[model samples]
Target: MTSTNDSNKAAPRKSGPSRRGAMKTIAGAAAALVAAPYIRPASAAPTALRALMWEAYAVRDVIGAFEEKHKVKFAPTFFDGNSEAYNKLRVGGTKDFDLVQADGFWPSLYFREKLIRDMDYAKIPGTANYFPAFKPDAFPLLKDETSGVFFGVPFCWGSYGITYNVGEVPVEKAKSLELLFSPDYSGRLATNARFEENIALAGIMVAHRMGTIDKPRPDGKSFNPYKLTDEELDGVEKLLIEQKPLLLTRYQDAATLEQLLVSGAIVAAPEFAQVYRLMLEKKAKGELDITVDHTLKPKEGGLGWVDTWLISSGVTDAEKADICHAFIDTMIKPETMVQIGKASGCSTTIDIRLLSSAEDQVLYLMNRTDELRGMYMFDQPSSTEKWERVWSRVQAA
Candidate 1:
């Protein structure tokens, strides 16, 4: 679900992918399929895209519509988290999946490792509408520095940050990340058990406080909040140890965090905007009389995840590969994206202009995000083995 912005609007090409640059040709069939509105049923046999994805992302209606129009099938396999999916793809081998709906950081596993094939942007003409952050050359994960080939197309996105009960924590204090680890709130704090997320937030807060707040590492420099270096891990781990005394418990999903918040088992901790959306629905339904403050981000910035669509290296067949390209096109459509936003509270990457017409549930996402500022996408590190060792210690502690 790449985004469309009002900035530098390219002339509409009713035909197909723009002649913006010399495009690569992965497979001859890809050319016909992209310009093709629907794959002709008689000529080519149907192929199934073994989609490794999340339950929320692969909405039934959207999948059904795509399956019907293209005469293709989707064999979905859901994973609990990005880390697990990364392993499944790695262990199972790349060729097993036709496509994987993994977090944006998946470039660390796919592109660098050469587990996936370089994509033909020309095939997915809709990519011209993606956010600047999503475009090739924007990040290492999206494009290869050496070949300048794009390995992934951004699909869906969501923000992660501290959520606090306004009744318990003052708005002034709620804005700070320190509130999450504050002793004053000890025994009342809760966090997602996702190792990287908890540790990333801790690292950012410490770096911001210690005046080492250099994120969005320019020139492809090493210091990254999502994937810490040995030195950065030391700082991150120390902060986690400090916060463990304050954390009531660690959680697995939004529902668990929601129950913890509602039961008064916790007051403040890290959460996704999706969970915040749920709390709002509960408030409107009179299920609870509590106000939650999720907007006020850590002055340093927060982390987010942008899941993208990538084809496995094993998908060399022209027919199957074309299907993957067609699926990417369908995913970015404004109508299809709106449906995804409606089904999953996560933000849809579509034309920002369409935000006005979106439902309250969809518009609710705007307030919780600050993509232009104070937000960084989650990432897998270059030295993930090094990062994982530190992360394990943080979790064990």
Candidate 2:
């Protein structure tokens, strides 16, 4: 569901209005940031491009450049989680949106449900710029298994791993998921509010703790974090209930998580890559007395995802589809990728070739796939209802 990046120093901030500043300007005029559109010249009243994606895509640095280049306005509908985005497209039928973003396995589901259309890679020259690890073949879910048509273009990726205050939590202890459960760290921990990821992570921890990670479930199927048996889920539920009191809060947004870490409200949590990046930026700006870093590989593999851009099936107009392709290409451009990185604290999908700064390289895990190995990449849970029930009960408890 998330990935992490940690660095002692942050890359130099580029010259321009920061995303926060831009959002504030828009927010001052509008009641909702989600409905806010990129302010374009009054003389140029062209149709606005609509996107349903993460909050990152709504940032001015990510959307404004494309709007300027294509001479179009952008209206981004921000969703906190992938399922929330999928449900919106599924119900609204993409007529209101031209482009949609989903992570990991959702592309296949979208293709299967006819919610998204296959991409014309030739139209998206940016795909050619992707790193070797991100090539189409490496991601089976992005393509139709039978037709072999790719449905999405990846834009950013990282791990949902153990993030801790550098000096407060030693590296040796931080490298294991078990540390979160340790009493020593009790009352100094936190986690995301997403049910599926928390449940999946609990399943993963259970599997590893039982030394049954490589074994099959009672159903004789291979052990999958997302497909844990009810018995296994019971363990997960119990574990979460125990961890509930330990947490400072079940944070629901990146901003809250960033503030919690910077303020030292909590020592550590399983977090996305951008939180660490943002913390490093804060530290670089002398906003904190302590630094934040995350483990690349926790003993019990971390949760990870690669989010991609997809053209919705409702884009029936030829010109609209062309614009969609162009938008995808522009987003993946090396320069734009870095710009989005600055605003989103995420690494671009293409090769790390665009990053020259040592700090940037360290934050993006520059050209290395080793950290990705053994990670339980996010996937559709076998039983969403069950996972949701467990998570709700844990929260209430």
Candidate 3:
């Protein structure tokens, strides 16, 4: 099986304006207009907060709540993936936004590169309510234990698994990752275009089926089943290459993949739990016939992911401290978290009792700690390049 522990870093691309750059420009202009001390200072207008995040996450109700409570308008931009968001920010320049929703693993790279500013915790009183594990300090970025200093706040989290169409693959036979890359269903298979999670899933499946484990370096910290060895890598590579002729398309978005599945053009694909839930809904309505399954990959581990909210370093200290905190508080409320979970079709770290009956399944899957730990976080920087190479070969075939 392909090892999921490969590097998680994407090759930094020159994307666009960062939040910091935008703030600096605004600050410079404001400073230029200032006169003598005797002159009364102009009261700053309430700033319009702009955010770039997942489409479902930028809910109008959530933004409206913040706007009404804080008396500031919020404008949000949406992106399908973190890399797209990062690239937009890099190329667009910093002045375009006040906040960016990022995954936990990618924020470390952004923080190290100074793409975002350390948050002013004092203003955001809501930071206190977060679970310790979700704290930015818990990540590798902040080496110290300062309570309020953070680059991001926890947003939502979900796990990776094979989401197959039951109409195509029977339950008993489809209970493993093997079905995803099996030659029998190659031309009908679909996969996410996102490199990290896709590659990790592929790696784990390849490693396990080959009877090998790919161990972490040095201290040998590793997960169950075991790691993949050199021979296993070769075998996994061959398996993936052979299966290439069967793939229908390299999906870059879930909506498209879901639509394809609904149309019966694709049989089985590796995807987030959210997509599976949607498929389940369609199946229930009789508009589609499908089965949602989370097969256990015995040897190869699954992929794990976390989403977070980060304050733009460029925002005023006063705004960052107060508004950001308020936002966090608003999101963590049991009712609010439930709404978020239901709308996004993903489980969150917050307690699930707060959610409605509709969200029970998603909440259950997300909170499965034992199952979650078995999945791999996309923390490796080199994995993307490697996956791209593999993907190219797959496409070429």
Best by TM-score: 2
Any runs in candidate 3 off by more than 4 Å, and if so which? Answer: 1-45, 91-93, 120-149, 209-238, 285-287, 296-299, 358-367, 383-390
* Candidate 1 runs further than 4 Å off: 1-44, 128-141, 215-222, 227-231, 352-374, 382-397
Report clash pairs, candidate 2.
Answer: 2-159, 2-160, 3-158, 3-159, 3-160, 3-273, 4-159, 4-273
Per-residue lDDT, model 2, residue 248, is: 84
The window of 10 residues in a row where model 1 has the poorest summed lDDT is 365-374
- Candidate 1 residues 328-397, lDDT tens each? 8888776777777767776755554444444463444543333623466677654667667777886688
Candidate with better TM-score, 1 vs 2: 2
Cα lDDT of model 3 overall? 0.64
TM-score order, best first, reads 2, 1, 3
Candidate 2 residue-wise lDDT at 229: 78
lDDT rank order = 2, 1, 3
Per-residue CA lDDT of model 2 for 34-104, tens digit only, reads 54553445454347788888877555765777788878888888888888888898787477788999987
Clash statistics: count for each candidate? 2, 8, 37
Model 3 TM-score relative to the real fold: 0.74
Better of 2 and 3 by TM-score: 2
Model 2: how far residue 50 lies from native, Å: 1.3
